[model samples]
Target: MASTDTNDIYWRAYFKAIKLQAGGGATEPGMGKEYFYIASNANRSIAASRFIPMATTNEYLYQEADNLMDPNAPLYVPGAGNTSYVQALYTYLRHVKRPRDTLTPEEEKAEKALTQKLKDAQATYRSERKSAMADWKEEKDFENLSFGAWAFKNARTFYAAWEALNTADGALQDFLASVYGADAQKYRSDMKKISGVANDILAPVPGLSMTCSNIPVLDVAEGIEKAKKGDRGPPVGEPVGYERPAYSLDPQYRDTMDRWAVEYDSTPSTGNAKVTWEQGSKTSWKEFGFENIEAGGGVTLFGFLRIGGHGGSHTEYENVKIDEKNSTVDIELKWKKLQFFNVYPGTWNIPQIRETYPEVVDLDEAQKLLIRPTQFLCASGLSITCKLGGQAKEEADRLYKKQVEAGGSAGVRWGLFGFDAGGGYKKEDGTQTSTSSYDTQKGELTISPTPTFGNCTLLGVRGQAVSI
Candidate 1:
């Protein structure tokens, strides 16, 4: 043996190196002593055992086994690869027994039904979602449309005038342009364009008309006049014309044609009867005349009294009769008192008299009365620091106090609990009284209380007064 130990040692070292390269643990089967024994017994070279050379003859199983033992072979597996091999075998067998394309009629029908159900569910979801979104949009659109309709209805007259101006061609157009200036023409053009755009936007919505025909339009002439006069502003603070039946007393005594008067027997009587009509601080008093006059005859004195500070005047008619035998003179006078009140414009819809009362009534009246102008009043010992405006302030204070004591509104009472001409509650009789009226000329609502015999008192009478 020529150095056989060295050869054996060299082969063992080569095998150990191969095992380490193959990631094999020391206890695992990698290039073991059994491989060396087999190779030596079969008269195979050590290199052939390590490389696992392919079979030259037609031994397919031998070639496959040799390839499996080769570490360098593409499909070669270590001991850990057995699990993957078993899994492949099971997969092949399963595929051979049942193909992927094979399906029974019942299974095909079930799959088709499931696909249809899924499509139907998807379609229903889309439709319901779309409908819900549409409903939301439609509700918002309805509110907008309602507002637009109200606006158009209220301003129909102005819109009509604008339309007419836009369509004008002849002398009328030139005249309008001259009177209203170039700005008016531009305004007309802009308004038409805006109206067109609004119509286009509302076209898709059903039940909305392109032309707001249902809205009431004012007269073109009236609209033009209002625009020219700059009366298109808000109606608040505008002066209103109001008229009511004011009470007047006859200068006659009870059950006699003789005029009623205060008689004074002597030139300076103990108590001289004085009749005074106060307008603010100004007062017109007539003392009992001691002049001698023929019996059954009277002297008529006519005069116009100015209501100071307030605007308006009233005519006073006085008749005086003197009886020389009795040393007496009788005086009678006729005068009017005006009551002032603030009013608000709105549809006064009285529920109590709506059903029973007739004549298509709509009273535009005051919301509330400003009873106390100043909440505080200053006073000094035995005298007052404030100089009041005579009978006007006095009557106003009296009315306010009365209303406060009665737990009602100040000034004049209105509504169901209000008193009518017969001194009865308006609700008692189905007849409606004109508690408030609208002033067409001034575009304001006014409250004018009809003066009765017992309620008439002279004071600072403001507003336009027509003598009755």
Candidate 2:
């Protein structure tokens, strides 16, 4: 949200709160944990201050789901004490429940009036916010140039929760079997039964195929995106998005470099301090005064999920930079959940087979893709691997069955096995740890990291390397 318009959806939800803190509104502003809604409301500022950051995953919300019927958690009631603040921050989610129909006409009118109040109050702060924010479209780390982003906060939690629901209930197993398939049950046994990760929010996921995962790659990707967008762009790379405010070393010359201030790495625990530029002024970015950007979250994925192959599910996901967590599926899993019949040249003209194989033998394309890498090496002779775990044993047994079913090393010669996932190893003192950042103090003046924004900074800035 910008100083230009706090009346937008996200900001509008929190405008009154932010404005009250910024001291534009009538009520006395809050600082740090002191921030709270009007005294007449819940008045539980302390609890809210702690809970807001964990708004998405707070166990209370999960318990409140009542079988995960609604995509949006039905728990948050607006203007109440505990839950309303979340609705305020993520404003689009008005406090809604299943029995709860849409807001009454009186409630709608009240909301509209409140919105007008918020707009009126925010109008006074708009110009100031505009001054504080730089033209950030050209910023490199931004996932999409558009300001709105819907990142998967804690997607693993959705699968984990589903795993839990399935495991805990026999009725659910019957439902899954009846609706989805029997083999669907096998997919999740590997999901939740693990001890450590059962409660771990940042659990490492299964590495299937040529997937690249780092610190829960899905979550890291979103954090990196937000960090890039939140910070300024580099000195070099990409043409200026909007026209420069002041320029003309020459009319013929167009500056391609970012003329705006370069942003600092705000990965610090205090959130983005923006120490270089103080907050509470038109000249600088407001201090992001929290630990978590509150950036990630878990979503509810209950009920019958469509299954794949022997029984699982498949979908092609796109545009994740702007989609919610529930939407990011099989992104890294290159598995072909698709089905296709084998086409034999000799049997191609068979009318019943439609120029395909005499028999419509469906094959997993991903299975072929999987076999290609190890094909030559394994065919060379024999191969052996060593690992120790119940999970590994389970996988070995499963692979043995599949390999046997495929005709005992003749049909599928090569084999591949992923290492252990869901790092649930017990810690020494029952505590997980962090090593912390290397902490580089040098401020990035240019776009490039090496020479500090590279050639653009050396030239003091240029427009379009191609143009020059």
Estimate every model's Cα lDDT from 0 to 1.
0.22, 0.20
Candidate 2 whole-model C-alpha lDDT, 0 to 1: 0.20
Cα deviation of 264 in candidate 1 (Å)?
42
TM-score result, candidate 1: 0.14
lDDT of 2 at 257: 12
How many clashes (backbone atoms < 3 Å, residues ≥3 apart in a chain or on different chains) does model 1 have? 1
Residues 1-468, model 1: lDDT tens digits: 111122222222222322222221122111111111001100111011001111111121111111112111111121212221112211221122111334567755754565354345435534543454344334534324432343234434433433333333222223322333335564234233323232122121222121211111113223223434545433212111111111111112110100000111111212111211211113111111111111212222111110111112521212111112332111111122111211111111111221222112122222011010100010000000111233423433453344436543322232111111111213111111223322223322222222111011111101110000
TM-score of each: 0.14, 0.15
Error of 1 at 352 (Å): 46
- Each candidate's number of clashing pairs is 1, 16
lDDT tens per residue, model 2, 45-139 = 11111101222111222222111111112112222223211111112111111122345677557556654544443443344323322333234
Task: Give per-residue lDDT, candidate 1, residue 343.
Answer: 15
